[model samples]
Target chain A: MDAIAEKKPVAFNRWLPYWAVFQADVRQTLRSWVYLFWVLLSVLATVGYLLYRFGSYHEGGIVQTASVHVSQLLRWIVLGSAAIVCVLTAGSITSERGTMADSVLSRGISRYQYFLGKWHARLATVLGTFLTLGIATLISALFLLHEDLSLDGSLVALAVVAALLTTVITFGVTVSAVANSTVLGIAVLWSMLCAAGFLMSFLPPRYPSPDRTLERLPYILQGNYDLAGLAQFAGWSLLASGVAALFGLGYFSRRDV
Target chain B: MAENSSSNMVVETFKLTKIYQNRQIALNDVTLRLEPGCVLGLLGSNGAGKTTLLRLIIGLHRPTAGWAKVFGKFMTPNAAELRRRIGYIPTNPQFPRGMTPITYLDYMARLFGLPKDVRKPRLASLIRAVDLLRVSGDSIAGFSNGMTARLAVAASLINEPDLLIWDEPTHGLDPEARRSMLELIKTLSREKTLIVSSHNLSDIDEVCNHAAVLSHGQLIYCGSLQDLKGRMRRNHFELDLEGEQKAITKSTTAIRALPEFKVVTLKHRRLELYLQEEVGGAAALANVLMTLNDNKVTLVSIRSVGQQTEQAFLDLVEKEESRGFARIYQAEAA
Candidate 1:
């Protein structure tokens, strides 16, 4: 009891639990075979593209070369990693047998912290894999393409892709937090994503659809994309993510662990 | 109402109830208060709501009706500050995959916001204390049930919590592990308030002063362990008598002829005396021994079974069930 009284003054950081969950979850996800397989695929695809590009000499304009190269890297991340993220995050809460109960029941953590901590951990890891591929492609593209790429364009394009991945993961974790079974979570998440993708495709470019984002990436990287559309899409993407996050937090906080 | 009611108690439940989604009453109308320095042993048969009651107190499961207060504050999912003063271990405790004992305990310490100066040393000491130093670096995935249970114990203690709540702390443990765990609980009982839930009555009898029994999601008994044991209607007595076969047989035959001593059995050189409720325990036991001595039989040993706690618990549950308490929750009736 005296020890506890002494500890009372040690400055308990409110965010420490969230950070702990984030760090541990990132470590776990990075070491998992499934996430590792996705990492390997993204790596191999980027390397294979670089080999093909550098193997032959072509004066294709820097814009075109960079666009195609960006597409190649983003191909694995935006298109392929969606399902991988679903598999990885859809069970973030539901798959836990008793670990969630154990951690939350212990000293100093709210279920909200645990849920958000895991949510961001998935965000960081999936984005981490994306960054690995993005940087590798950009570094290689600078030397092989032998043209001054638009730095602003590349950053913007990368940010958009990052935003897209974040949305995918947010919804995936939302499904995880809501569903009681990992398998069921995966099914619901994929269906939600597919339905959202379909709806976005039919709507105008301002709707922030995955297809629209990917389709406009070349122009975005060339600095010729529509700014109004980008702003609208960014706002809408952010709003969608916020809504998903709120729903997850609400349900997870109120429901039984 | 809950806040003002249990200010002086370590744990207070006010008509606490929990009904699962399927309309199953996992806990019903359980109201009890525990003073500080009290070690409460939760007892029940299978599906007896022991886990449910503990979970409700720990704020793991929201009650369907009523509420619980720990340390004078209401229990809720977001009550981090309140929970910080409590250490909890769920039944069949599970640790996250891809972590070793060292890493997991460290994570638990960090969850409590322990500074590095405290967290690092504390985690190191806990791992060694739990006898996990040998496997400190190995992945927890390979640990046995006993090893995992030990790690769970370490995790629960990382915060130096004032109140410890454990659900089935000795469950699934091998004999040696179970003995060691009960010893740990007994030692901690001297310093902190604890609520331990288990079906093992002797474990409770050994470590707890206060006891609560549940049957079919309803509290059947709550008070001192001695009081609960005292509820038994009759008592058992056993003896080892050494003498000539005819002498022992003649002594046992005379004892068996008593009207009050309904259960008397003799085999080999041992005699068992079961005193009915109407029989005076001390007088009946004395008469039997005197008869043996008068017959020139040597009293090698004499003892009474310590299983009265088990029998007393069974009696409570049976009494509750006999009132048709379970029939109220039957699915067909619902």
Candidate 2:
């Protein structure tokens, strides 16, 4: 303290890869009981639904009589697991502010890198879950329905689900970055989602056919796809998520940890 | 600005100020320079801006006015390269509850961009250094506070940083754990420049050679610990005498009459004499002994009791309070 000397910045290679944070977050998310429980519940519900559909088959063969819509099944599963995704990602940044931020941020990583890394990681988790559900739905359709599901159709449906999840996860991350506590982050995100869902339900139908907008909204329940509708879905999803992620980065870069 | 070229200076600040969103001024016009390889004890009461200053240096908060430079680089939001050279252990270090210490450290190493060849050996050595070898595989959720703190130390050292900052490192630990933590800090200080912020004066006294005292977001004093104590040392001496009441009373009266003695009080068989500032304690004691001898008093023992560092710190804070700065002295009392 007594002796003051000239200061010089220490030179070092600064490499802050988003992949590092992404990998760590993925491992932590997978190990969490909440995530594991969600996976188990989703599997059981899918299997049980398939069993019920199989049991309902009449004199006709399972291939022609049984009705097991893969898109509708995935929609229900995604809705069921929404809480888990929200709970896991809603506190990702806010919770770490006091706990691990001090150690991690004090190192050679920018706030943008940290936020992006986490966003990518959580998005990856949701996408991975959707992929697994897709495979299971396909298998159940092939065995129980005795119908060959088109790989291209399944991919399109999966893409729609992935796009929707990206928006949800990005919204959660934004709230987490801005909120002061984990509870607050979770509360804000869930409330916003609920309010949005409630408001969207009130809007009058603009198209002649109800199925037209349903295909474009990125809902997993709708299996029919028009190229225009899918393109609109992907564009809106990316735009919303990109905007939310940018907002999160903006707030996080300036806020004190 | 020209002096910023020297590599020996680890941290430098110029009029650094931080005002929270609520309008609370956490730090104000604080300008400090810290050299490398010195263990600096940051002494302050709670909310006295110790943590605020540390956060600014570590780039956790953007300064409201002025600026701080670490390793000669201004600490901005993008100063990631500058931060890589520093290791920081926060006041409360936390991790994902389910991860083990070894996994956590490995994660930290990867975040630091340590190559695989380097990370494995470094991770193993840090685990051994922090003495977490046996339970390194156990989850952090089950770790005691002390174990968590030890793990934090290991994680911060994963990159072998040149500057290490610990905020209340020994806080919330039992006596034994506190001692071990201090010993670890002491050992680390030998190799790396260290900054330790704590309310415990004795902890600082045990480990820090240099000290900076903060009061109400203002730095009141900053210098070597010995110099600070020396500056605050009082000119006083105590003597234990075995004598009759009459002799003691006579000696007190005689000692009081001496020109060198500023204040004299006698209680029981002990005597305390305050000498003039210019009068050295040794010379004043010599005069007191002569006065006692003349009264036929027997001197049992004599010694110089200068003010301890704790007292010096409190006195400095009190002086600052007198200058109209608010003081949070209850932390010191605790």
Candidate 3:
């Protein structure tokens, strides 16, 4: 078969949008029974807890203890299962690779664009899930804790912090892609998070009152509520989440398929 | 490259090489050029590096050396644009399970940013082209392997990619389905460059104008099918005669006679002959006919070789094996 002329590269263009990719990823994620189960169960649990602890209505007699406690518990829940998002992203790539999806690579797009497109779609999914849980937790806390728990400026700062912390989700996704197994990826993500938490505790100049840290958490959850810690949270979140996203971006950029 | 400026070559790999982490060489300094509006058959046995070569071309995996470009740009530059220009169909395509072609195709179409107006017509056309219109709305869980293959093919075309790469596109199809898929590939090649990998020689013998045979990650041969057929050094011919023994002894020793045939049973009738490379096959046939005429032997029939070209191909594979490559000739035996 030697009659053909030498080969040359074909010109390609990138006209697709990030939103479309994100929409496709989310649709696929929603179709998963596991994700549906998590969404339904998380919502139900939040609803049941609110109903059992306090009636459907919020009254002035509520205490800050339960609100703060619930906020902390929800954060833990969100972070704990966040590894699943990574697993999902990683699984998508691995399964395609296993079946030799390189067929897709013959397309015009470069590896960088493919990886970014996928990363963008996956990140959007993580953000969407985070929002859903946030709404549920917010509604539950508002009902159980009532107006007795004031929404302070500190609360606004905390909300920002939560959003920033959630950037950790990107790290999980990246780890999932490079690591061999979903379990190992999740472990890597968890270990990294635990390490971060431990490092945060060791930071010199601990807050004057250790117990007050619990009381201060809800303010931190409320994003921009506390101007005092605003810079710290923003600085840390940007640096940490940005670095995390880069890790994923870097891993994905170099990966085949 | 210049003559077809507007009709640009879609997929191109220049001296591409892929060395697996375990040190297995998947492709060795492959330099291939696929022009627009043509179909190329990657004919090889399993583990012949067909898939590996495909992966490198598509940028699914990094090459150990050299580079590949799709739609005229290196894979790392403007990747999204590159993706927009090519379609890929892998054998045994997997879905997220329970996903219907409609959803999946729609998702892919959207990913390509095909507007609602464009997506509707494009999706409908692709589904019809692949003959999956009836089940486009059905879940993949219930689809057969052939159906999935069709869907994968259809999805790859959603963007009307200029280059299409399909690995074993008809691997598990029924004969009818295989024919339809091959025909579809032929139709696609009218406007797009298509590369298909498969071990079905007969299937390829029909659709492929250009082909390359891979053995142990190295291309043993690459060219047009006609050129390959033309490269054979010998032409075969069979002769039937009465008093075969007398004719066999009388014929010149320059021509090799088959000793395998039973002369006693034929009494006087038997088959025998050969055509050397320098002797025009037709001239050799004339000589044999003359010899038969002189010996008063009646001619039964004369025809060109029935399947010597195929046998010659097997012989080439054996030759390659003897030179150091592991032979997968058992696939032909199957």
DockQ of every candidate: 0.59, 0.48, 0.36
| Model 2 interface CAPRI class | acceptable
Share of true Cα-Cα contacts across chains kept by each model = 0.66, 0.67, 0.58
Off by over 4 Å in 3: A1-17, A55-66, A79-126, A145-147, A153-161, A206-215, A218-226, B1-11, B233-297, B302-309, B324-334
B1-334: candidate 2 lDDT, tens digit per residue: 1244445579888878999985799997777788877899999999999999999999999999988988877888667777777888889887866789888888788777776777778899999988899998998899999898889888888888999989999989899989998988888889899999998899999999889899889887878888878766466678999878998998898888888888899989999888886777667778888888988899999866653688789878877778552444532432
State the lDDT of candidate 3 residue by residue for B72-136, as single tens digits: 77765236566676688766677655568887777677666666777777788888877888888
lDDT tens digits by residue: candidate 1, B94-202: 7777778888888888888777887888889988899999999999999998999999889889888889999998999999999999999999998999999988888
| Steric clash pairs (candidate 2) | A8-B71, A9-B71
User: Which candidate wins on TM-score?
Assistant: 1
lDDT of 2: 0.79
Q: For all the models shown, what interface RMSD does each have?
A: 1.7, 2.7, 4.7
What's the TM-score of each model vs. the native?
0.89, 0.86, 0.79
lDDT of 1 by residue, A123-180 (tens): 9888877876787788778787645457777787787788778888899889888898
Residue A167 lDDT (model 2): 81
CA shift of B291, model 2, Å: 1.7
- The alpha-carbon root-mean-square deviation between model 2 and the true structure, to one decimal in Å, is 5.9
Ranking by DockQ: 1, 2, 3
